[model samples]
Target: MSDTNAIGLHQGSASDLAAKLNELLANYQIFYMNVRGYHWNVKGPNFFELHEKFEEFYTDLLVKVDEVAERILTLGHKPVHAYSDYTTLSRIQEDKDVHDGEACVRGVLSGFQTLIEFQREILSVASDADDEGTASQISDYIREQEKTVWMLGAYLG
Candidate 1:
């Protein structure tokens, strides 16, 4: 029998892909919570707009969180689930009680930046592993987020 993972990918490459995916999962969880905080705490003139936007952001993040975890499972690996693990693994740090709309937008921009860069790195690894599923997934995220980074930058200026 061939050395293959649950998803039929080479065992070693799938293991590496699952590990990188868990890292992405960790960052997404923290980012989701940060956006939740921003949605709840944002105030002032743009409250309604920013609040709604943050809600949309968090909701989308929640979906990706599930998708990433499921992908890890498909690769024959357990996804890291604890908040403690998330906090330790995530590159995006927690944002506490941010009420200013501009500040929240800046935070979102920073998150997109981190995610895009990391996703690109993952894409490289996925390509090397010949894991087309993971490569396609990360590519879509990077493409969407690059546009978001541009729009958020415009919002800031």
Candidate 2:
């Protein structure tokens, strides 16, 4: 007989969901580090505000990273914890020494967009598998990230 997890999800289904969750987690990890770099290195007249904003964004991303990892574990899979795994799995590229405030904001927007798109994909997979927990988490992330993109766009304009 085939095995199913505690949530009645088949091992294959759980494996797929866990893989996607790991990818999402990887992206968040890189994005968080990028934002931290932005916070630490942002320059120009808008320094104070942009620094504070980047810190806020990174802090939020950090929380979501942990949540995604936990979600993967809940699905009976190990979360990828190494930086090398993040670099390989994440579509978001590593950013370094991005001092210009506008450039940093642009990077943030781009990362947010990538994450939003990625999570939407995960949302569909989780929904199909009846993983309401993963689906709901991704949905909440999408809603919040959409609002963040709007806000960031406004700031850019």
Candidate 3:
């Protein structure tokens, strides 16, 4: 068995958790910026409605980015804060010049898929590490995002 860290999480597991959290942070940063781009650039007859929706999504993403960075700190790792760092580590990339309503919604759905996958990975590792705080936080995200995926899917149809 691995030794536990000072924070009561397993040392090797905590280190791995921190690394994964950093990856999650990177993805969130990219996703947040992407949504912000969507908010700013979305156009069509649906502009008014989609603009507000994108704003709501990006704002929520910003909060999650902060939470993920803080969680990394709690695990005894510094979060990578630079955009360049995010670009390098993130699976999600910054979307640019995407003004179409349908495209923006598709991008959001794709980003959410990536997010759910990352959170699920984090959940599994957190559970193994016995890190209830991390597990609970990601679990909440997965549930909320799943509902969002459904609602957004309905919007797309």
What does candidate 3's lDDT look like per residue over 1-157, in tens digits?
A: 5487668887888899999999999999999999999999999989999999999999999999999999988887889989898999999988889999999999999999999998999999999888999999999999999999999999998
Name the runs in model 1 displaced over 4 angstroms.
none
TM-score of 2: 0.97
Best by lDDT: 2
Q: What digit string (tens of lDDT, one per residue) describes model 1 on residues 50-101? A: 9999999999999999999998998889999999999999999999988899
* C-alpha lDDT (0 to 100) for residue 3 of candidate 2: 85
Residue 139 in candidate 2, Cα distance off native in Å: 0.2
Clashes of each: 0, 0, 0
Which candidate has the highest TM-score of all? 2
Ranked by lDDT from best down, the candidates are: 2, 1, 3
lDDT of 3: 0.92
Report the CA-based lDDT of candidate 2 relative to the real structure.
0.94
**Stretches of candidate 3 exceeding 4 Å from the true structure:** 1-3
